[model samples]
Target: MVNETMVTFQGWIGTDVTDRYVGEAVVASFRVASTPRKYNKLANGWVDGETNWYTVNAWRSLGRNCMEALKKGDAVVVHGRLSTQVYEDEEKRRFQTMVVEATSVGHDLNKGTSFFTKTTVGAGGEADDGALREFNAELGIGGPQISSDGQALGDFVTDEPSKEPAA
Candidate 1:
């Protein structure tokens, strides 16, 4: 959908990311609130304008990462396609809601600092075992498997499938 609109919001996470299984796929959903502020020169301070709330959803690996990394009140930037839903309440009043199917979500650097961990992707595919092993190594699995020569840990990992998992 080349015509799909791309939107980004700088906001605070309004809710902790909730992970659930939709069939076999994992999805993480959270809410974010973006409020505008204006300087009140006469008052010698800044005043809050309007606040907009959005629901953000991430799927698959991104969803899993969000579940692991995001918490309520964290400042973040969400980038995704803008989507909407309309429904009527029991009283027959119509209401519209907005959501973003996030392609990427990260902590807003303007508010504070954040550390990033690179996710491993293999030449074959994201589901490949090589990528999974690399991801585990990046987390320092097995308490640093450094060789005597001080080579980088996980250098011994190979694409070959082992008959038995390492103990």
Candidate 2:
């Protein structure tokens, strides 16, 4: 038997990411501040409630990428699993802590502009590839017709048109 789990948490980074190497794989760890609100009916208003701090850990390529891009105070959306562990200190006092094992992480839009790089993968229809190739060629990114498993699509294009009177 097997069980699968998924969890999403949105919060601001409480500190800069710390990166280290375990054997050959690189890992990054950081803490995030999450504020959950509560409604106070008696006061007839919403209360600025307690803030929970969560530690997030990312491994391998993701860790390296995050170390370069993520920073303190950056709002991020993290998808992963929750883990808790208990241990006894030297004084024999017991304590338990919770942390998240982040699989995929990205900056939340409220923090900054979102940049998306589109890439087409798998074996789609020939027509689709042809059209993609035409667009890619016109845009000068290898005529999207042919693509490897991890080939980069192209540059980012803005949907917003120039601000001017249409002739």
The best candidate in terms of lDDT: 1
Best by TM-score: 1
lDDT by residue for model 2 (94-163), tens: 9887688899989999768766443343243111245556655675432233353436655555565644
Instruction: Report the backbone clash tally of model 2.
Output: 1
Q: What's the CA RMSD of model 2 in angstroms?
A: 9.6
Per-residue lDDT of candidate 1, residues 55-157 (tens digit): 8989988897888789999999999999897999999999998889999999999999998765543453243345445655684533445432334465345
**lDDT at 90, model 1:** 100
lDDT against the true structure, per candidate, is 0.81, 0.75
* Candidate 1 runs further than 4 Å off: 41-44, 121-167
Residue pairs clashing, model 2: 133-145
